[model samples]
Target: MKRPIRVLVAKVGLDGHDRGAKVIATSLRDAGMEVIYTGLRQTPEMVVNTALQEDVDAIGISILSGAHMTVFPKVMELMKQKELTDVLVTGGGIIPEADIKKLQEIGVGELFPPGTAMKDIVSYIEEWVAENRNF
Candidate 1:
């Protein structure tokens, strides 16, 4: 049997609010994907390293501290350095639409804003993994 998709959900930087991260983690787990949730106050390097060690198929970052600009790019850079290019780096929070576009331009995947449906998030990750990850 093929292994289930593995995802690492993280909260980078000083974002103390982790309710959303926890929700995403649980939802993903319920969707049959394995989720590794790194609790609050993580750095970009730490997130990437954990993703590597866990061999996750994606990294879902939950940021509400207005650090999307710095956090996403730093994670992307670290992923590049670690040759984790196949991993999807998607997330959600209070990010502006323009910033989302910019982050997408920089190779970050879809950035869902607050109130995005859980099914949508689940479907996106499922489709992304189906297309990108070689099982």
Candidate 2:
């Protein structure tokens, strides 16, 4: 049997606006993925740890606190530090386009800003997991 994709949707740093995160989480869930939401004010470590323990296929971090640079890299670093490279890391927020490019360059996946269709994120994850998942 094919497993439903499991995803951890997290809010990092002081970003308290979770309406977007909740929306994405619901969309991903409705798309037949298991979702765990790590609520507001989560550290990168918390997110990586949760993803590790949950054994998620991907992590969707919703960041609006202008800390995408620090938080995304930290999460990516932790994912590497803990050897969670098989887990995909992506996010949505107010990140600049240039920074988004840089993040992708460093191995963080896509960064979706507001107004991105939920289906796009879901499809992106599906394809990414299929291509990148080691097992």
Candidate 2 regions exceeding 4 Å error are none
Candidate 2 lDDT score at position 100: 98
Clashing pairs in 2: none
Cand. 1 Cα-lDDT? 0.96
- Residue 18's lDDT within candidate 1 is 95
Residue 34 in candidate 2 has what lDDT?
A: 96
lDDT of 2 by residue, 8-45 (tens): 99998887899999999999999999999999999999
How accurate locally, in lDDT, is each candidate? 0.96, 0.92
Strongest candidate by TM-score: 1
Model 1, residue 5: C-alpha shift (Å): 0.7
Q: Candidate 1: where is the Cα deviation over 4 Å?
A: none
The global Cα lDDT (0 to 1) of model 2 is: 0.92
Give the TM-score (vs. native) of candidate 2.
Answer: 0.97
